[model samples]
Target chain A: MKKDHIRELVVLSGKGGTGKTSISASFAVLAGKAVLTDCDVDAADLHLLLRPEVEQRHAFFSGNEAVIRQQDCTGCGTCLDICRFKAINTTGASYQVDPVACEGCGVCVRFCPASAIDFPKRNCGEWMVSTTRCGPMVHAHLGIAAENSGKLVSTVREQAWCIAVDKRIPLIISDGPPGIGCPVIASMSGVSLALVVTEPTVSGLHDLQRVLALARHFSVPAAVCVNKWDINPGQTERIEAAARSAGAEVTGRIRYDRSVTQAQHQQKAVVELTTAAADDIRLVWKQTAAML
Target chain B: MVAKTHGRAARIAIASGKGGTGKTTVSLNLAAMFGAPVQLADCDVEEPNLNLFLRCEQLTSTPVTMLIPEVDANRCTGCGACGELCQFRGIVSLGTRALVFPELCHGCGGCIRVCPSGAISENPHQIGTISVGQSRTIRLVEGRLEVGVSSVSPVIRAVHQQLRDDMPAILDAPPGTSCPVTATLLGADYVLLVTDPTPFGLHDLKLAVATARTLNLPCGVVINRAGEDQVGLYQYCQAEALPVLLSLPDDRQIAEITSRGDLVAHVLPEYGLMFTELADKLQQEVLKVAGGRA
Candidate 1:
């Protein structure tokens, strides 16, 4: 509970389906006392393995949505004419706004001569605080077609940090979203270490470079773990060389195993199952723990 | 095979709410089945893998640029109209100077219009690149986001601009149901949602389906790596009345080939026939939906 005592480790894969969630869940099982947060708000899968029971839920409101009051006056068609995104539609009698397409730019509201438009806060998604077999977990779901995922990710991390500090947890483990976009940036900001989980393929190598560059850009120290390294050992070696030249340490590698999928089917982390990959994951976790 | 034609070339977008669910695999195979007069655009700028499968000869590369507001310090007054007008928080005034965050800018151009001091001027900032190439008879276009750039929707827009209108186009959307995915789904006539059978896969598929429904776009499902234990995805698709267009079973041979940068349809001719059938079914579905709309 001391200030600046909580060290954070984020598990990320630049390309999706490279075993980011599976690895993070296994790490949670190994690091029993760490507070876990799934920062992949868009397609979070950690809860599937962690089986967190919800303790608190809060609605996330970040953007504006405009609504048209139909009975104000003449259908001047001004809002439709000025809208750039083509978000406004007409039924030949009145004008309406498409909630999904509307960017909430407020241009239509300002240009409406009838003053019949109302801009309301949009309920984009919700974040939750829950307890799991591992520890306290914070996660979220971005509403369908809603924007501002980066903001929601930051909110989830903030809640996770508060829990870590209040409970005096020494570490916070975050499962990050794929791609080097806004959400990834939000997840990487101020994290102690970033453990990038990558596969051994051309696409995997290409994306790992980008994610490493992003981590370096944010000045967050990054480590690499090649998942499914045995699938293509040649590419796996190439990835490790690339990571090394880029100043990232190759913490460990996990072998390809169908039991990884079997574990997912059972809603359990790989380490919890008797699989060959579980031993490999434990090795990766040991190295990752040393870095922390 | 039944020969079919449309009034205009219809666009079919391949998307998955979760990454690594085989969006690129399905898109590449479908494009291969079409053979000629087909264009495939990889809008997953962050990690475009279609080029790895298809042997594309580069034709041209174009940079995608956005107009970001630049504040001129000498334009007199310290009014903060531009700062107050931007909804995205792209520009902010701090005491004496205004800071512009180009990555946060959606390029709405409202700040320049509302700036009272005439200090704001638009500047071009390159965020990514769009490349067009030829892979056999297929026209391939891909967007590659430059490192350090946060937004990718503009690059996707630029790639869509390269679509050849006279031919059918297949767009491979980025993973996740966010702005980048929406940018690719914008004008598509139909969407082929590819997903695996897992709890995570079903969870994100619902989000993708909801997004397509919000745009009023008809969609079908393609189950990748279909296995024995994952019947949840099938049940959900059936209950929703969503047709399962095709299912590719989990085969170790297919996985090995794909891992080596080879297409399953090319290495295994039997899968070619299946993809051709998929293309035909897609054409039929598009026509049926188009006919219903008319």
Candidate 2:
């Protein structure tokens, strides 16, 4: 059933503090020969869990930030006045820079009185193609407070897909960002399937709806799984019902266990931890494989 | 007819720019220490986890809806006025008809506002549900936006409608500095930013701080998983002149307790006293702000 161009992507919850890195790592191990990509560039933690052996690294420029030449600024202040990002600030006789406020928009480059402003492609982050025990993993790190996570996710996913094709693999299991935002949307574009892993809580249910809706919008087949279902049976049932109502397949319900943490503490997958959680995870992986 | 104001209480929202920074833990514990017949609103409608930490009885919930413009083709003039009026650019004009991207529509009614003809009619779009519940001490209200609904601001606004006077109120806000967080922070007396000690934590913590400063609200941080990540958070706070109100260390027992769907304060009795102290410090800060405003 392996297709030349098919790939499977998974998105974790938006509610951080969830054990997404650990769970994704487990899935990676189960996926053995498949290429993996960590698309949570804004806060990529799968690298921490997988300990990927980075083979190649490169600077990634998502867009351009307007850089002003001080000598040519002329103290006219037109660039400062028109910039929506307020990246440019006028001092007594000169100007100052506020990189945090800069959205990398080029309004200042066009409006500069002395034509001193130069728009350079902003180096937002670094992308890497690395080797993990599971497979070749594509991941990236977005610089502190830098936006363009959507672009980074797309970049890594594209590379991951390309690598899978080159390797003649059938699957590219991508770890997507949480929420129904731009990064999550980017993670879903053209994927054969998206497995949405969520928890059994109020916010979990709320975010699940949004993420699922996003999957529906993209016309991608989606499957849902509630991690730590034992903690809240009522909420878990509700999530299951919600998923069913939306025509999404509920792949598996994972019970809460201390082994998940123990596995993380030992730097191993839950399936290797020899616990009920591990058993549940193996079954979940089986379901994922069936999807493929 | 205009209804009474009912002397509703001021809502102080607790928010962060990133998730899992302990927003719900801080917000719920804050309500617990306020010790009055207070109302706690979880405005993170997309994920209302505030209820997970609180024991609530007697819940009343309602479905919240937003307007999705449905154009009547019979009366439509194809003047392109609706598409032109849409600020979000969600409306796509075809040669003879128009398509609407419901996700991008902010429900601002701007398109309807500008339409010369009476072709554009508002259709009810059920985005989420708002619920009211009661713990032993405080009343709880939360909004759960229907999954896949793009706009959460309206659901947040609905949660805000449950504000009550005569007691302190805490609004647990969703992470991010987007429209939903803005709606939750509106008219709040104070904003407490919960954060952690990692690189991403500090990065997003600054965003929440900037957002709070821009809104002119008194803000502070409650560092969750304190020890290993403290340096980054502390440095940022000192540089920004933001106070580090409290620190919750990386305690495995606490983590296990939370994993069991119990708030750390509930499982660790000692943290109850800590939350009380945090509340006392916050009250002093809130009073100072109020005095200045007067």
Q: Against the true structure, whose DockQ is highest?
A: 1
lDDT measured at residue B3 in model 2 versus the true structure, 0 to 100: 18
- Prediction-by-prediction clash tally: 0, 9
Docking band of candidate 1: medium
Task: Using lDDT, give the best candidate's number.
Answer: 1
Per-prediction DockQ:
0.58, 0.12
The per-residue C-alpha lDDT of model 2 at residue A240 equals 92
Q: Per-residue lDDT for A1-292 in model 1, tens only?
A: 8758889999999888999999999999999888999999988889999999999999999889888999883699988877767778888878898887778878778768889888999998899999999999999998877774589999999998899989999999999988887789999999999999998877888889989998888899999999988878898999999999988999999998888888888899999998899999999999888988
| Reference interface contacts recovered per candidate | 0.51, 0.13
After best superposition, candidate 1 residue A175: deviation in angstroms? Answer: 1.0
lDDT of 1 by residue, B1-294 (tens): 011245668889999888888888899889998755799999988777788878676668888998898999988266777777677788887757788998787777777777778888999998888888988768899899887576677788788888877889999998888777888898588999998887777877888998888777889999988887464888899898899999998876766677788888988999998898999999999889888877
Alpha-carbon runs more than 4 Å astray in model 1 = B1-6, B65-76, B93-101, B116-127, B146-151
Model 2, B2: alpha-carbon shift in Å? Answer: 39
